[model samples]
Target: MKANKASVEFAKKVSKGTPYKFTIDTLIVDHPLKKVTLSMGESFSYIPFRVEQVPRYNNWYHELLGRRFRNYTVFIESLGKEIHELIPNIYRGESVPLDLFRLSKPLKIKQPIVRNLSKASSYRGGLSNRNIALWHSHGWYYENTQDRWKWQRPRLFTTVEDIWSMGFVVPYITPMLENAGAYCFLPRERDTQKHEIIIDSEGSTKGSVYLEKGDGFKDEEGSGYAMKVPFLVEGENPFQMGKSRRMPVSKETFSTISFIPDIPEEGEYAVYISYKSHEDHVTDAHYTVHHSGGKTSFLVNQTMGGGTWIYLGTFRFNKGYDQAKAMIELANQSDETGQWVSADAVKLGGGMGNVIRG
Candidate 1:
């Protein structure tokens, strides 16, 4: 049968709402001497479905299915739905619902401490001094052997606090911005909608970059052909040597462009619009390209690897200081180790730097 004809027939059968028995049979009607009989084996019994039942079958029936039976349901469901809707159905089948299929044991996601180095500064001021004071208050001393004060001993900081902050920031900020996305680690952008924002490494001299568009964005440009965004390379430089720019996306045309910039200087790089909205100030979203070969130690908890530590800064939200203090207190109360210190101790410069005299 023609593929299109078979598809039409399949759709008609699904929409008819009639129960049918699917069977397999081997023909043995004409035998040489003795007549043979053929036996039929039932494969599946399809139940007639109501229109209202379509939604339940589409949603909950997959829960009862295993990998072996999922494809069969998908094929039947696909006949009655658009391709895009069916795609989600396929994804639902692939994912095991945690609430429904609980594991025999529990799982834990460990939290770690992360520091941001991009905001570090060389100027000596209140922020830097406050961090030093806080560090000292926690029994951590500053070593001036390298002409810069470095943390000399283990310091008291909450890894869980850092992770919690990142979890909030990533999810909250990612969905808020237009075409805004975030990754635990940077990814290479193959293509994106014309208006969609993407982050990728600068292409190499020998390599080429291109953008792909979907069918919904046809007739985007004067030419009907899909648009291409190319990254030009000169000599050995991989980084782009021009001002940053944004591309436009129309209702009819959606496409992405690619380019190669001069190879980065062995460090992380991030591309983000500083402004939250057109009216907002530009915020810096960072990306790390090469993290190797540096004297600075990198700590990554929730936000991807920031930068090497240079100068630490501290900011106080006076308006919310009391609430912040209370929250920290609640967090410490739940900590297993009684050693957890109150935020007030650090805020007052006494909890971290206790100089005991004999």
Candidate 2:
């Protein structure tokens, strides 16, 4: 006695984004029979069957639907008008298992909506493998001296710009960009935590030191200088939990505060400063960053953008805490009179490389 085997193969050659619909035309089988039921040596039979398949691009269609909808709304509403429509929710039928077949009855599957391209795009995957770093305007802060959640920015048109900008970025923009496949990092608090986390404090954040100069320096016992918490419950501080110091601007006497960060690796780091915003804050607050390359000075406007990490230029820093290490010093030497200078926290290590982005 001898045994025989049957084999099947499937092949298709097509370009990308081409629709494929296939159907098997014919199939045949040949076999040998040794049974004495009839005088037969070999038998050949035709097997009638059909294999039908169609491409289902649910993901691409879904993304297209969302993008088109957003574009349409923006274009229509930009003319200082409104478009209203009622979208009803309908329940689809239960899913059918793969093992089951609809032979006697018709099986219908919804195809993706196809539209002609308005413009040819090279990137089929939107923002995939892209890194985006963004931050919301400002956030709420806790004024510990007054024991209340104070608004960091001015309240304009019912809501402050801090919360207003955050309303779009956190809940809307971030998710949309992420859906398009982008890794985003906004160096602010996005959690529901009402308590403050002091990031650059002694023992709280290693390899950092804060030093103060002359008298008239006062430490504000609250966070929001180092970290920013967007949402805050009632009686809960939305500011970053940390201590920030402030002193009166000086011209004759050099009153200064310095924040030094220990660099474990010798590389380029993006310097950022966080400070409090007050009505009579110094307009020309002097800041000097001493890095491996050299000393870079920047005059920051402390009257606005409190509780947010403001980026200074990237600079090269030597490893470890030495005289040539990365250090940020704020001198209370401003031309503005009857104003105060505030210093909260200094951040490093957000740069791309040691190549300076001057």
Q: Highest TM-score among the candidates is held by which one?
A: 2
lDDT of 1 at 258: 25
Clash count (model 2, backbone only): 3
Candidate 1 TM-score versus the reference: 0.17
For model 2, how does the per-residue alpha-carbon lDDT over 76-132 read when each residue is reduced to its tens digit?
011121111111112112231222332245323111011111214333456654557
Tens-digit lDDT track of model 1 for 1-358: 2223333333344445445443323323232433222222332223433334445543432333333334443323223322223232223343322233333343231322223434353323222212111111222234545554444343347332323433443345322321121122212221111122122222222222222223221211111111123432234211112112222223222332222222212222222211011111111211121212222222223121222111111122121112211111101111122111111000110012122221
Quote the positional error of residue 56 for candidate 2 in Å: 48
**Predicted structure 2: lDDT:** 0.52
Query: Model 1, which residues run further than 4 Å from truth?
Result: 1-13, 16-99, 102-107, 112-183, 187-358
Which residue runs does candidate 2 get wrong by more than 4 Å? 1-204, 221-223, 226-238, 351-358
- For lDDT, the strongest prediction is 2
